[model samples]
Every structure is written in C-alpha cells, then in structure tokens.
Target: MKNTRIKNIIFDLGDVILNIDVPVASQSFAELSGREQSEILAIFNENEIFRQFETGSMDEAGFRNFIREILEFDDLSDEAIDTAWNSLLLDLPPERVELLKNLGTQYRLFLLSNTSSIHITQVNKILEASTGVKKLQDLFETVFLSYEMGVMKPDPLIYQKVLAQAGIKADETLFLDDNYDNIQAAAKLGIEVIHVQKPTTILEYLKDYAV
Candidate 1:
C-alpha cells in the first residue's frame, strides 16, 4: 500500500526517470575533438565550467566557448558542441512515462534534475519522440532544473527551495534519486528517500503505487 502520510514525490531526472549514458557523450566529444574518451570523461568530471554551467553561472555561448577551449578545437560549431553535450541523454521509457502519468493523478509529482539547458531540450525531444509526451513538464506538477534554479542537488538549499516553493512539508514528501549524496542530503532534511540503484528503476520501486 502507498504511504498515506506522503503527499508529494520529488523525482530525480537522470537514471531515475530518464536514462542517460555518460560514456556515450564522452566518446562523442572525443571523436569530435580527436581526444581520448578517458580524457574527455575526466574533463567532464573535474571541469569547473561544467559545474558553472549547471548552476546557471555560465551562459550557453560561454559554455560552448569553454568546451572548445578545453577540447582544443577552436573551430567547433555550436551545433556540434550541443550534439556532443546532449549525447548522454537516452530515451525516456514508455513504462516510466506511464508510471509518472498514473502517479501524478495521486500524489503531487515534481522533477528535480542537476542538468544543463542543452541536455534538457534534448531530453524533452526524446520524451516526446518516445512517448508522445509533448514536454517533460506535462508529466509533472513542476520541474526544478539546476541550470534554471542556480542550485543543484546534494545541496540543502535546493531541496529547501523546492519544498518552500511547492508548499510541501519535508516529512510529508518522498524523494528518489540515483546519487547517494543527494539521497543523504534529502534524508537529512527529514524527507524520505529511496536510492534508485542501477538495474532497478522507479517502476520497480513504486510498482504498487502506480496502480
């Protein structure tokens, strides 16, 4: 049975609902810049530009320029950079879409993602193409994006802001995320959390509630 006390659900975008393959994007960037995939992946993990971009401290043009500079390919076009950056995004499974549709009818559903604008646009496209859902926002009550919010998960302020803006109490909400740090952070704030591990999905975790 569903938890009667839980009034809202906050969902992490990557891995929880949308499938993403980081190494694919790393390979794409490597191919474009003639760099090793490992090097590209390392840059993504360590680069300040990536964090800045996700936090809204950097604009698209600035982020593109930074990518070109880091990749040492000054001639890379905007389309090429965006394509490589968005390559990490995969399809939103139809089953997950249906789960969201069913859950939204019961509890208040919200999407919280530590993602970039370039990726979000591509994700929406993938969601539309895969499930006939026009936009991701249509599946949730509200979408909280790192790039748009200027804050990312693992930060208490982001969760606090979501709770404040949604007018929901932390103890009355449930959060599901693939990242352990994010799960811990939300749990610390008294919001119940489920670590949506690999090979198991929100569909598997909340199958009972979907009906």
Candidate 2:
C-alpha cells in the first residue's frame, strides 16, 4: 500500500522504467573478451568499475579502454568497444512513458539513476527516436544521475539529495527502483518505496498510488 501522504514520485532508470538486457551485455562482453561469463561478471561485481564510472572517476572511453586492456584485446576500434559496452540498453516502453506523462500532470516526477555516461548515451539514442513517448527528460521535474551527482542509490545520501532538491518531505515522496538495497536505503530515510522487478512496466506496481 502507498503512503496516503505521498505527494511526489521519484523513479529509478534501469530495470524500473527501462528494460536492461543484462544477458546481452554479459554475453557480448564474454564473447568479445574471450573470458567466461563468470569471470567477466566477477570483475564487474568485485571491482567498482560501474561505481567508478558513475562517480565520474572515469569517462566512457577510458572505461571501455580499460575493459579492452583488461581483457588483453589488441586495439579494438572505439566503435566496437562502444557497441560491446552499449549492447545492454533497450528501449523505454511507450506505455510507461505515457504513464509518467499523465502522472506528471499531477505529481512531481524525478529521474534518479545509478548509471554512467556510456550507458546513458545508449539510452538517449533509443529514447530520442520515439515520437509519441514522453521524453525521459521531459517527464521528470529534475534528473539526477549518480555519475553527475557523485553518489549512487542504496546510499542514503542520494535519497536525501533527491528530497532536498525537490523540496519535498521524505514521507511525501515515493521512491521506486528494482534494487532491494536501494529501496531499503530510501526506506531507512523515511521515504516510501516500491521494488520494481518487472522491466518496462511500472503501472501495475503504481496502482495504489495512482492519482
């Protein structure tokens, strides 16, 4: 059930509103690097590559170059590296965009994502191509990216920043994301949260809070 006091909706990008092809990313990486899926994933989880990218410690080209070098690849073209890096991004559903557009009419909407420049570039290319869908930039009152913000979700500070930025009370905002740790982080901050596992579909989970 939603908090009856909710006045704003804050959304997470990836699996919440956008469909991420994790398998595509993993498989592509494995094939390109000649490493087993487990090995590649282990590096992803063990190292803070994604985290560093998000925090702007590294740029997209640098990130890709590091991956290529780590895998001992010999001078793969930047485009090829980018393709492997971007293979995970998929289109945002038109219906979901519509839902956000309609909701934007009533409540404040925000986009807070733990994503990087490379990944967001892929998302933007796909999203901008859609005509009828609400542009992600337009749907939100403000956009906060972890990379640009110097913080990531599941960190209490990020949620605090969102609330502070929106000028909304914690209890007045409903935070949505696919990651449980992030949901838990926001919950600990006294903001209401929803765990969205279904990619490209949020209306089902938002029924209780629909205005």
Candidate 3:
C-alpha cells in the first residue's frame, strides 16, 4: 500500500539527489596542502567542521582559514583554497528536478541541506546555468539551507525546525538522505526515512504516495 501517512517530503541536497564528488574535494585539499587524504578527511569527519560551517558558526573564508591553519599550509593563496574546496560540485540531473516538480503537485516538497555559503553559491550558479532542469529554487516549496538557518542535519534541532516550518506531524513526513545518521536521526522523530543507495530512484519511491 502507498505510504499515505506521508504528507511532507524533505530532501537532502548533496549525494541524495545532486551528485557530489567528495573525493574530489579531499584530493584537491591533499594535493594543495601536502596532507594525506585520509588525514585531512579524518580531521573533517572528526571535527564536524562541515557541520559547523553549515550551521553558520563559520563563514566560508573562516572555514578556509581554519583548514589552512590546521594543515599549516602557509603557501596556499585564498583563491587556491577556495578552488580546492569547491571542486566537489557536480551537475544535478534534469530528470530528478522534473520528478520533484511532478511530486510537488501532491506532496509538500522541501530541501534541508547541510551546506555552506561557498557550496550554495556554486550550486545556485549551476542551477541558473542549467539548460534542461527547472532552477533548483523553483523545484521545491522551500529550501532550508543549514548555513542560512544556522542548523544542520543529524542534529535533531534541524529536523524539528523543518517540521515546525512545514507545519506537519513527523509521522507525516518522509526524509530522503544519503547519510545513514541523518536518516536515523529523522526516524527517531517518527519520519519515514529512506536511505538511498542506487537503482531505487526517488521517482520510484514517490510513486507510492504521490497523488
């Protein structure tokens, strides 16, 4: 049976829908800063620096500076660092945007992403430049960016914030994210969560409850 219990659909921007080459970013950092990718990623994954950056405690420049300091790469210029940082960006599929638009005819679609200013700026540029897809801004009813909102996923507060903003019961919401922890976090609050892997396209998932 269709999960008619679902009323709101929340999406994670990176990896879930939009393809992100996280390894590209890590490789760039390693190449520029002379640190091993594992070491740099260890720092990033351990410190939740990305989460802090997303939650607005650190601006793009500040985050870059912090990383530079951490790696002790005094030789790298700011622009170089920015370039390395942004190398993770990849194209968003036009088909997914169209699917989301179709789903919006029924469900309350929202984007809740743990993204910072640097990444978002790049994303907006890509959306504007895309030829086939509806602009990312136009595909959803609301886009709740973590940097702008000062909250990030896997943190329960962000989920509560999205639920309150959408004015829906947690049981009525379905959250799609690539991160297991983020999915589990939302599940804790009663959201029907999907941990997307591959082949199981979101369109297939939406067909169940889509009107």
Candidate 4:
C-alpha cells in the first residue's frame, strides 16, 4: 500500500547522505591552479561549466579540456583532473546507507542528484576502496541524476520530473537536499522539505520516517 501521508521521499547526494570535503577539494584545486583557494571557490559560483557538465552538455573529457583552457595550464593529465575534481567527495557513512535501506521498506525512496559521470564514477570508486560501500543505485527505487536527466535542482522541472516519473504528488512527497535553494524550490512546489544542514544529517532529520 502506498503511504498516504508521505508516500515518497527524494534525497540529494552531496553533503546530505554523502559526505563532501569542500576544503579538501578547494586546497587540491588551488595547488593545481597555482592560485588561492578563494579564487578557485569563486569560479564554482561564477562558472557555467558546472551546469554544463551537470546537464550533460559537457562530457568528462570535455570538462577536463575546459579546465585546462580556463586555467591556461595544459600539462595536467586526466588522472590529475579526476583526483582534484573528486576531492570534494569524502565518504558515505554506513549509517546513511543503512537508513536508506530501512526507509525503502516503508516509504518509496528515491535519489535525485545533481552530478556528472566522472564524479559518480569517482564516488563509487572511493566508497568501494575505503569501506566496500554498496552500489548507491541499489538502495533506491529510482535514481535521478542531473546529468542523465539533463536538468538540475533549483529548477522546477527537475522536481516535476521526479514526481512524474514516480507517479506521485508533491504534497505526498518529502524531499531532502543540502542546498537551501533546492529545498526552497521543492517547498515552493508544495513538497515537504528538510534542509539537511551541517551538524545534523539525513538519519537525524528523517528520524521520524525511519521504521
């Protein structure tokens, strides 16, 4: 039977369920770029490259090429680029994985993420290398990626797409994401939201939903 009150739950990947070390990535990029971390950080917000990659407009190789072009540093290899780009993904706590499995037995659980092919590949490799983490897709009934879908969060279409795919309604769905803009976007569309913030986690925020 479908859960009438909260029939479905959609989760974001980075920082919400998965741990990301932005500082580590920043430092890595700084070293590679020969610039300050602050400068590298600024590029993330101002550069449309992120959107390009996340929306499938750019491939992993193209991204590396763009990085070299923008940085004007052509000597970095593909391995170097993947390492620096993936530095932000730290670890996925076992508790979160366990929680997702538990939640799946009750509400319909879904994973909606803004990610690219290179990053997802690296995330799985990191997890497998460190703790032998299970495949992320296996834990959820559906995995909606921005790169695969060609749409990202904070855009109303993504949320609509998830609902459409799941055959669910916004009011009966709960969405959790680390980014405030994403939370706002879902909430504005009448989806329940938990802004998964620092010092708290998906396990804690969704404590009420855990069976």
Q: Better model by lDDT, 1 or 2?
A: 1
Candidate 2 clashing pairs, residues 3+ apart or interchain: 54-147
Using lDDT, give the best candidate's number: 1
Sort the predicted structures by lDDT, highest score first. 1, 4, 3, 2
lDDT of 2 at 19: 81
For each candidate, give its TM-score against the true structure.
0.96, 0.91, 0.88, 0.92
Residues 121-172, candidate 1: write the lDDT tens digits: 8998999899999898999999999999999989999999999999999999
Distance (Å) between predicted and true CA of 133, model 1? 0.9
lDDT of 4: 0.86
lDDT of each residue in 68-174, candidate 3, tens digit only: 77878777787888788889988776667777877888888999998888888778777666645434568788889989988777989999998888788998888
Error of 2 at 75 (Å): 1.3
- Each prediction's Cα lDDT score? 0.90, 0.81, 0.82, 0.86
What would the per-residue lDDT of candidate 4 be over residues 1-211, giving only the tens digit for each residue?
A: 2335898899999998789976887689789989998887777667787799999999888999988877778998999988998888887887788788788998899999999998898877765665566567777888899999999999999999999988999999999898999999999999988888898998788887887
TM-score winner: 1
